[model samples]
Target: MSDVAVCSVVSHKFVPAQGMPVPGQVPASARAPRNDALRCTACSMRAICMPQGLTSDELKRMESLICPSRTIKQGETIYRANDSFQNIYAVRAGSFKTVVMHRDGGEQVTGFHLAGDSLGFDGVSSGHHSCDAVALEDSKVCIIPFHLLEAMCREVKAVQQHLHRMMGGEIVRESSQMMLLGTMSAEQRVATFLLNLSDRLRMRGYSPTEFHLRMTREEIGSYLGIKLETVSRMLSRFQRDGLVDIRGKDIRILDHEGLVRV
Candidate 1:
């Protein structure tokens, strides 16, 4: 098995679940199936994950079980570091970044979770989040009771499989970051990060190679473990080489192949 597979296996070993009712909280109106959801309802990610396996009837039943929440605004704290963990947060729309504070009071971004991504899962074991989750833009999310999900996993084979896959994907992404940090040069790291971001943007129905940077250069440097000046210099170099064009935060990839060449 590859290192990526190993990471997945390790992550799944700790199935984080906390604050779920023992028997599960069945909303009084949750008798019907959630199959007939014509629209995504509250979740933006329904197109990618939910509403696919469900029928109208199933959806109707599930709708009663679902509770929708308001969208989080940009720069708002979804949850602070060490906050009590109660629910599993699934990104219904927009984006968020998980961050940790350094001893000197600086912030280090741990991960960015975009639309359709999930956060707060790692907190299940400790009952408190180790990092802060903040919204990058106004975002919506579904809050599923953690214990309910865990209980459902016991009898629902499909839910179990879905959890497995999601956790596995998280492992792969985290491992890739570790590898990139350990082995890549500063330029390689920045290029690879852009490519990864572009791919994720494409997956979410956007222009992969052409988009405005939502996070600032300072934030990008924090994410990449580099200095702001270094990031600026790299972008200038890329522009000179015609690998990418940058005007303010707007970036256009002129030569994807050239950017990838190490």
Candidate 2:
């Protein structure tokens, strides 16, 4: 596998094309229904987004750089490998999985993105996406125009620093995944995966001990570099050992400490 690096600094300015809707305006077709309206300033996930720590005035400026949130239905492609890298998306709802295609026609599951996660940084260096991002469920994402965001980053130190940190996070995550695949036992890998998911969900205010699996056993196995059969067996073993309760996709951790010691 080629080593993945943090996205390069994109330095460009954006100009609206004639006949195009100005940035940040929600088209009627793209707008969520009244009860499910999307607004960055009012969003509960704002703290986890790029706009975190901005003043009210700065936030308004930040909002002007983003297009209205759009939805991706289940099984839909959010972006394909080699697609033009114009924008990075912030997940507003639901989840997605990113896969990298190989020369042999096989694909590797690279990462799973949940609400508040950013996508498209992998495209910055080559000016095209490095992998395919697909919706795991019906999802919504706020589009941040790359050029405009780059310009804003120049003037907003916090925004620039935050973006750097986000990029660094991607590198760290990939490194950890490599370690998991190279050294961990099947049971250890499975346990670590569950704990990681639990921590992420907890950060989003969901119950740490219980949640539904968004990906299938096969997907989990692929991400962990294990066989699908092994994935199933480990999960069953965990349940038998009273480490967790699994009824289909829903899982409740019965002993978080036991899982940590797997």
Candidate 3:
């Protein structure tokens, strides 16, 4: 609701509220999870996207706080620029890319989000989204209605602190991107992208040395402020030098130290 999230001043007991749909919201093309219940403790992404200090009592309430997760197909827009900000979403499955289009029809890929990532923060300041979030694959997102979330934050100090930390992380990520685009060499940019993605996957309990790239070279180029040809060339060079093994979207980091030196 605000540029920076603040815990609500009014305190009330946390309650299990029903899902309140957005006006004219798009119907989910797929069904909700099996059994029609979500166990936050059992969720793979809880450690990444959820508050760490929630007691068992508090975590139970989160089942109702986050509405049934929605599954969107590849190429579907999660939220477009200018859409009203009603909820923030967490990726429960798959990945997404955020893009901004100029008046002249040119587009730039701003960021890539994988499972355990959050979306919709771009809308907080203006009450409307500033970019388009599109799934790179069939993806599912846990939607948290903003008003209810604000109320939860008011009564839960741990939840409030977690929200603030996430918001701060977003700012730091953007600033790092600025530095990447402004000063990094082409090789450094490409290397950093791979290393950064590797680190995230590792954090999410996936193999750090081997993973698939959900986004294409052109998409990576746009995000890195480089040409598509350069992206391809960099990958080719890395492979030739035995720094990495990349075939299509599948990549294996052959030499982490070698890549890092770039």
Q: Which candidate should be chosen as best, given lDDT against the real structure?
A: 3
- TM-score winner: 3
Cα RMSD (Å) between model 3 and the true structure? Answer: 8.8
Model 3 clash pairs are: none
Expressed as tens digits, the lDDT of each residue in 173-228 for candidate 3 is 89989989999999999999999998888889999999988887888888899999
How well is each residue in 192-215 modelled by candidate 1, as lDDT tens digits?
Answer: 878888887787787998987767
lDDT of each: 0.67, 0.77, 0.78
Candidate 3 Cα lDDT to native: 0.78
Q: Which residue segments of model 1 deviate by more than 4 Å?
A: 1-44, 51-64
Off by over 4 Å in 2: 1-37
Better of 1 and 2 by lDDT: 2
**By summed lDDT, which 10 consecutive residues of candidate 1 come out lowest?**
1-10
User: What would the per-residue lDDT of candidate 2 be over residues 1-262, giving only the tens digit for each residue?
Assistant: 1111111112211233343243454333233222235667678788887556788777767776666677776777667887777778899989888887779866678888889899999999998888888777778888777777888899998889989988888889888988988999999989999999888888888899989888888778778889989999999999999999999999999999999999
